[model samples]
Target: MTHRITVTGRAGGTPGTGRRVRVLAPAAALALGSALLTACGGSSDSGGSTTVTVGSNGNIFDMPLKLADSAGYFRKQGLKVKFVTTTASTGTSALQSGSVQFLNNSPTGFTSALAKKVPEVAIAVSGLGNPLGLVVSKKFAAAHKLAAETPAAQVAQALAGSKGGVSSANTKAEAGLFLKANGVDPGKVKWVTLPSASADKAALSSGQIDWFITSEPIPLQVQNQGDGIVVVDPKKAPMWAAAQAGYGEVVVATKSYLSGHASAAKKFVAAVQEANNYLATHQGDPMVMDVARKVQQGVPDEVLKSSVALVEWPASGSMDAAGWTKTLAFVNSLGALPDGAKVTSENWTNKYLPAGGQS
Candidate 1:
């Protein structure tokens, strides 16, 4: 069932740069044209295999999809999925340009895309448990008489009126929702935008900022380096954890792609279920670690193992409508969404879910 199809194209650029260079715009346009040509240019020769190019941010959340590929789940489903490490924004561009058939990232990114009329829809939930969390420098926590075990709401209150770093405006909005839900005034905190997660981690260690909210393994790294303590574990956050879990990481595809390739999309969704089931039953197995290391390079095995325990995958790869509603409510509350923008559960459908409870 192994079908070899070489995906010849440009990868989406590094994540967290926060700016798309004008000079590269022309090149990207060319790349997009090339992608469209290949996809439409096809009479596939892979013994009827459907190649599903996937654009990803290279985050650990994408682990299950990568694991599925390594386990030959895609092959079993008659698919060849090529994963490209592109920033979320760039992934949207790839989706539009037909460079990739599937996109993986936070549903926040998909929400933004929908605001722009991107027409991408979430087919399945990837992983859950808010990947983002709050971390404070040991000195700051000590100065404020805060213990590593302090409640997250109390920590947010203590950090009020202080400078904190985040990766983006959307990220800041998410932090704001969590803090405000816990009775802290997000307006009181000054949010500094760091270039990347590594930059935020460095800033946190150097005391350049009082506290920052970011996703793992930076939160994991901060704890490992002993420079900070995780004040908020999104999985256990007092008020907003469950809401955040609704749309953490999702597998998305464009409406156009789904219309023309409905069968392939369903197959991909089934493969995701297969992967989630594997993780549910075999978490921390050597095979899981091997796949995790392959997908989340540069991360220590222990951190990867710890992260697995932190995240939960939906057994059926089902979408949560209530959770999705709560997520949009918070995003709108911040006025971070585009004008007249709304994301209902209709934006995500479970029609493609595999039958008989795949998990």
Candidate 2:
């Protein structure tokens, strides 16, 4: 499915400012001391709570974990979750170096890190619902006679030779898959690297870029300002709907953490599942807003509300084996997975999830 390339904090939100956050990391590791304690899992400083240093990319994609912290789920599970805001690149290295015990990121990102010989495993499926997509400026869409109901194939053809904005190289690859799925020539679309969130907004506004592939709440932000209309809604697009049927987001951790502290891992997954359940039923609840406001500071409430409407939370905390397989293949096709890396469902486990997580 088409997904936004989350390259930086500004593109998503500031990392490490969440409700219960204790530390923040650069795109590189800033503190290796905590990493060692997390890997050891029995540090005296942890008191009675198991300290799990979790890394996040500082986007709304990490909302559930933040929600869990806000809702007291982590405390209920007797876990002290230490969140580290970092890019997937830095987070993966942190994971390998024992700086963090868990990471919340796209499955593709996890797999790419896995192929690089990082001993990590997918523990649970985060929210999905094809939240990643591309948007065309309303002006551009109107000029080209592109309507929301226009067939994707027709729209793809109209986008030929158009300048498109993306957050990262992986997202550019995702954009290619999206265009090809809609019967467009990926080679014909000129992709400009707009890694900064402000740059993307300005590019789209000044006609410097005709369209951009992004995830919420940028899509919602664009629509709220009446600057753009979503041309490819991953949730509504038939191609994306089919391709991402059983996939969305993943929570991963180093195999070493799971093996050394299995109980803590289970508690962490349970806490995530608890938060996921709360989100499934309370999208518009004030609790959601409270957490959103804290983690996604500076984002407009209207935009956050719009994003909640567009995103989907998983019904249960489970990860489907087949879906994981499909996700690996897709990432492999993108040439993101390293060669000689063995791919298997063994890389994920449902043992830690609540009942019904296994499929």
Candidate 3:
């Protein structure tokens, strides 16, 4: 390593006067400083294991990845996990630009990437079922005579001509699914794009929105705040049970990155699988509960406890063709899949899996 320091005599010095002196020195100090900051984005360490950044949606749904990190599964696999702050909108682009090595999120980002010819592969799956919950404000529920066990038709009728809070493309799709499943015309509903989870609460509490649909534990959080109650739990819904997709929540890496860091990618999937197993069997355990604490902001333990209990982690981490197909179908139902964009082998695989139960 080398460092060249140039010292100029004065601002007014003539360029031809040779006033600038260059001294060449070893860059040990500079190199040492960089070495101290060992994990730089997705860079590899020459003397040790691979270090990379993985982006999770930072919600309760991504808790399995958080468990992998908090439970030392990443370290066990000799992978240093640095979390990069990413949203549904930016994660895939970050993955494409090499700023993020892996993204643990919904299939939407990866699917959208393939639409533009960006090759990212789904290497692993952690969760199996849809965990979205629909909560309606007290006033709306009371006025509509809605309850958790309300008939689907009544729920749909109650939702008609009501304002619902949606945060992103995903939420809007979820809301659409709720309406379409119950045979309600989507035009009959009004969607308010409330950007944050807190915004979901604020809108509902102020009566700005009648219903809000989102994944746990926001629905649980809303109920805890006494603003509303959950009217739909996807886990209990027949629609989700019939079309549950493992690709609903998965780990994705760019095709090029996986080609070079296949070993690291495999190790990551295995670690996440181990974490998923722990979460499935040990939801009540303090450590499993703590993953939510690490990633989620203001949600409480009781809410997370109930929310985690509702989430069903697949026994295996490996993904299959059918699950991807089902997920793609669900996205397509939302009018989300870009035209001519198909989730082919290029966009996903089970080659990196540990080989076990269905996912």
Candidate 4:
């Protein structure tokens, strides 16, 4: 049986108090004509100087992508990589607009795009499961004399009882599923939508919402502020169950780009594999602290270190069928995906993954 943890509390208030608010409209659908144009914009033939533009959000989930560029892995692969920073939706837009050759986003986001019939496809799996947490304001928890490390049930009870508000990136499916998995019905809780990681951090720090669901790095940053409490750690739950049955962050590309520059894409995956190897070997290295600090900006070293342990970096950066099936099933249960959305093996391919897998 699936376990549900519910937190009951007030619904709406100033930021930092649990409240429900409106989310912005779903990102505008990209026109196929525009997609065709964008897909052809940055293409260069094989052996030519290939400039592959990529975009990603500022989060620890994307560290491999960043590390690839920072460590000159892209150069080693004979491809010129240009990185652009954008929010989840904008990054999707960039991919659709041909502004980027590839996009690093959660598979949940891609699931929405696929449901809409967008032609984008996943090339490689970057990060797995929803390594996320719900951070509540310590000031608010203290003000109410709540216990630290409340279970999902207690937190859901608190939110349901008091009408408190919760906030998260509405564009990603994991945020909503995380709430639902814990028994905080989206309808019952006051929801505020914060798109960017930076914005969510500000909303939390400024006391605009009582609780916010965020992935690693940001949660670590929130804890460093010494004013927020991590009410749930999805990783330590069960069977690495959280990892197996949770959403994934994937590297995606347009069909046109993939068809035209298959080799460069393969090289890109190899570079990420290299970075994952470095992360595994030097799990406690200070370089990770530096990367986390640079990527998250303002998050402390200790919190970043703790978060590192929570993240599971697969050696191959490839998707497993069982994990994908569980993720799709969970999202479907939440109605986050359309009816009959199956995570079949055909939905993914390792054609672009590194040689001999990710080790």
Candidate 5:
């Protein structure tokens, strides 16, 4: 139980401010478009397809939408969807301003934005389940006598004094769900912010963090490199039973756009649903793997194969009420729907509309 503080800290100000800036990124970004932090999301591509853009933070749960772009599902819907690569620390203001047509995120993400009064609604469902894993450094695992099959509560107990590597508060929030479910105080572990993906692995390898939490391939890669052990494999029974009750990723857009552009929105969602269907059937196919590599770029074959298999692509991109009910419980504990969001067994569709998404 040695406390190791990784001193890879970056400055928080223009030149000499040694203090870290503390503010809610999404809310601040929304309040002042000055920090809008744009990566650009929309533009026409080819043929006569309408240009649409979706923002992504590279969570493996977003694979279904990426597959849609690669597999011509977007073309099939007369749309050319572009992905705006972004960080988990930002909000959906870009969607509201029409910089992006859709924002691919988890329920926790959307709820955080909604809590800030950002007017957006989920138009489609993507991946489901927890899609996240807890990777303990090999040394830490050996020290605590932890293993792949360790019970969730036991692992949670062991984390009472440990540092967790997180990309942002969003990652921490998502991980909080897992900790909350395991009856552990999420704040027990000191979260070390490592914004770059490369830094996450490096920090863990250097024994700077006791554990790391992230989705897919990262955990798989860590295991491959022998730097960490998968204590909470999202693919396993115990992990799923504990944390897979909520929506993993959803496609959302602003209410103003959805109100006027229902046709495009529905078409876009249809394409995502089609891609998910194909992914559900052709998971291990060469073409699927190729698309995965293209979308996830730089991921090794073994990692992609394992991640693709484990990442649950919801059939037809639908959401069920029971799943959503659990989602509400785990996400902010309110049975009430997201602001301007409606529900159906199959999908949220245009939840903003009173008549089941019909504008």
Candidate 6:
């Protein structure tokens, strides 16, 4: 049987942005099946082929996945892989419906999913820490004579007290956690959702919002405009620092999918490890641009370069379980998780990791 899929949305929408969506047509499976289904379900003994679908929101953080595909890592590992470009909601939906075999998303998404009984398991962590910052208009910052690297609490307080000074976050969870952690009451802040990084940038530049919570490159872009200041560096914030002490970005797969395709799954992890190595060494390579172009349209070369500096590509296949536990605790502190919600090291499994891939 064949299936057709359609992809929509701007190439560079943020965490919750619904843009950058693809719809699979009825014949999509047949049309891209051979190319997409390499080593999905077959046995190592018979060299049987397995078809697996992998999804991402197409952000720079997901560059390694794109690099792996372009480098033919999956093919070499004897698996056919289909790349699905989607937003948070859509990607989660695809994973739930079995339209995609695995998902690459933030740890928050996975935590939320597990809390909701979504039956998803995190296999490996890609990147850690927030990798984001709070950007404020230079006019506002200068008028207040705010210092760069101002504490996040001060930034949150400023946004909460400003008239018509709205703050935007990619998702409620992201925005909510940031606010609570920084000592700002979300209820007292005018919080809005801007799905696209570009859209958020526009709002910041136009003074539509007093503050915007976004990852690097975007914050760097605002700095380049000379109209924004980094009032809060999440990397330095204690709450975010504690969260990063837990888990960051992770590779998630359905329990059933991992159980059924063990070898292919291992190969997938191995390929990712190699891609991460490449990214670390060739930080400014054009391949980074190629990956960026596919997901974040209109990403200037400077922004791409800045993003690389902000994101620290992992070198091994192992996850920091202790760090992840700290992250879970931070989430609990923000009331993002239910009381007594516990995340043990057991929530992850290294059995499927390739030899030497274990952290």
Each candidate structure's TM-score, on Cα atoms with residue i matched to residue i, is 0.82, 0.82, 0.84, 0.74, 0.73, 0.75
Give residue 159's lDDT in candidate 4 (0 to 100): 53
Candidate 3 per-residue C-alpha lDDT over 1-359 given as tens digits, one digit per residue, 9 for 90 to 100: 24454654667766655423222223655565465443233445665767888887776668888888899998888888888888878988888777788898777667877888877888887776667788999899999898878877778878889998887677777777667878888788887888776788788888899988877888888888787889888754545532554456788888777876778888888888898888889997889867777777667889888888776786687766777788888777667777877888667777887656334
Off by over 4 Å in 6: 1-50, 147-160, 163-199, 241-245
Error of 3 at 324 (Å): 1.3
Could you tell which candidate, 2 or 5, scores higher by TM-score? 2
Estimate, for each residue in 134-222, the C-alpha lDDT of model 6 and write its tens digit: 67787778767676767667666776754323233333445556677778877776665665767778887787777677666677668
Candidate 3 colliding pairs, count: 0
Query: What number of backbone clashes does candidate 5 have, counting pairs of residues 3 or more apart or in separate chains?
Result: 0
For candidate 5, give the lDDT of residue 210. 87
Whole-model alpha-carbon lDDT for candidate 6 = 0.68
* Per-residue lDDT over 115-147 for candidate 1, one digit per residue giving the tens place of the 0 to 100 score: 888888888888875666678888888888776
Instruction: Point out the worst 10-residue segment of candidate 6 by lDDT.
Output: 163-172
lDDT of 3 at 105: 72
List clash counts for every candidate, in order: 0, 1, 0, 50, 0, 40
Ten contiguous residues with the weakest lDDT in model 3:
17-26
Which wins on lDDT, candidate 2 or candidate 6?
2
Off by over 4 Å in 4: 1-49, 143-156, 168-209, 236-242, 342-346
- Distance (Å) between predicted and true CA of 31, model 2? 20
Cα error, residue 260 of model 6, in Å, equals 1.4
What would you estimate as the lDDT of candidate 1? 0.76
Kindly give the stretch of ten consecutive residues in candidate 2 with the minimal lDDT sum. Answer: 1-10
Off by over 4 Å in 3: 1-47, 355-359
